[model samples]
Target: EPEVTQTPSHQVTQMGQEVILRCVPISNHLYFYWYRQILGQKVEFLVSFYNNEISEKSEIFDDQFSVERPDGSNFTLKIRSTKLEDSAMYFCASRGTARGNTIYFGEGSWLTVV
Candidate 1:
């Protein structure tokens, strides 16, 4: 039962700084995604990648964001400049084949920008 892993379950940062969140998705998974929940807000999709390029990206993935698969098992999300509104629980998820199409998620990487 291998699962996705995200580092720094929590992070606190100033209003303007750089932050890099890391994740290791399941070994055989095909799709990788980044979703965020802003405190009490609903889960929002930031981006999804497959075959080493972006499949889809939501409006929230603005100029300040970037993602990478630096190795066989590592996925990373980088934010060059943070803002107060950037505080959220960032979840790394992988979609796999079940009986049908379904997506699963990691616990999350929490970011607090103040």
Candidate 2:
């Protein structure tokens, strides 16, 4: 069984610094997404990518954030000028098909901005 994998399970950074979270999804998956949860908040959707382009994005994905698939294998999320409010547990997920397909999520990458 294939699963999503994330690097640097936890990251600590200063405010105004930049951070990149990396993830690799199952080889056969087509749709990919990024979601985050504040320490005591509900999980929130950030962005969804498909066919090399952003298919959907939530308000949280503002100018400071970006996502890319530099090598068609690894998906990365870059946050520029991080703020204390940016600290959260970010999850990378992927799905094979849209209908009745299960979305697999990687072990979250915890980001701490202080």
Candidate 3:
């Protein structure tokens, strides 16, 4: 079975520092997304990417954030400057088709900003 994989499952960073979370989605999946869950909050959609361009994004994905697929296989989320509010479990997800299709989520990459 295909699944999404994330690297550096745990990361600790100082406030105002930069951080990058990496992921590899199922090979045949087309839609990719980034979602985050703050310690006690619901999972929130950050951004979605398809066809090499941003398809949708939440207000949380502001100027400090960016996503890129440097290689066809790897997707990366970069935060230019982190804040205490940025600490959360970030999940990388993908789906073969659309909303009705099954979406695969990677084991979250936990980011801790001090």
Candidate 4:
């Protein structure tokens, strides 16, 4: 089965730095989503995109964050300025929209801001 892929499974950065995380969602999926988890914390949804616009977004998607479809198969998330609290597992996910459908997670791009 096709799977969502993310690069640099782990990232470490200094405070106030910038970071760009990459993801390749499933080939045929229609909906793309981003979620994050601080170590030992719960999963939190950040944003969802469909048809090139943001379908939904949570409060956590602040000005420091932005997403884009850079190509037919690649999606990216950029953190303009990282902070110590930005350290966490940032997961990229995709699904076909069934409420009951299982979404695929991209292993995860763990960011550590020190």
Candidate 5:
């Protein structure tokens, strides 16, 4: 089975700075997503992409965040400005058409905003 992969496994940034996290989901997957888990909290959905466009996003994914599939294989999440509240482990996920919506997640990109 293929797995989602993420770059810069960990990052530390100052508050109000910009950060971009990158991922490569399983090659055959059809749907992609971004999710984040704040320290000691449950994972929260951020956004989902399908057919080269954003299909859905959560309230927590406000103006400060954006997602894109820059190429056939790369999916990225950009935080326009980081905040202490944004410190969390961001995960990249994907699911194929036959998986019954069972998304597979990457190890995660841990972000620390000071």
Candidate 6:
């Protein structure tokens, strides 16, 4: 199975700063997603994108957060004005078009806010 890849395996930034986490989904996948785990908490869904547009998003994804497919292969999540509450392991995921296709997650980008 193809896998998703994320950049900046780990990052440390000050509160109120902006951060952009990048990911490259499987080349053949049509659906993409961004999820995060806050320390020991369960994973939380942030947003999902398809056809170059956002298909769904969670309440956790507020104005401070944004997702974009900058190109055919690059999907990115930008967090404006980061906060300590935002510290978490951000995971990039992708799935095929077929129903029930497994969603594969990247190793994850660990964001630490000071």
Candidate 3: what lDDT?
0.95
Q: What is each predicted model's overall lDDT from 0 to 1?
A: 0.90, 0.95, 0.95, 0.92, 0.95, 0.95
Q: Residue-wise lDDT of candidate 1 within 1-114, one digit each (tens)? A: 788899989999998899999999888887899999999989999999888988899999999999999898988899999999999999999877442466778889999998
What TM-score does structure 2 among the candidates reach? Answer: 0.97
Measured by C-alpha RMSD in angstroms, how accurate is candidate 3?
A: 0.9
lDDT of 2: 0.95
RMSD of every prediction: 1.6, 0.9, 0.9, 1.2, 1.1, 0.8
Winner by TM-score between candidate 4 and candidate 1: 4
The alpha-carbon lDDT assigned to residue 3 of candidate 5 equals 90
Assess every candidate by TM-score: 0.94, 0.97, 0.96, 0.94, 0.96, 0.97
Please give the TM-score that candidate 3 achieves against the real structure: 0.96
Q: What is the lDDT of residue 68 in candidate 5?
A: 89
Candidate with the larger lDDT of 4 and 6? 6
Ten residues in a row with the worst lDDT in model 2?
95-104
**Of 1 and 6, which scores higher on lDDT?**
6
Error of 3 at 72 (Å): 1.1
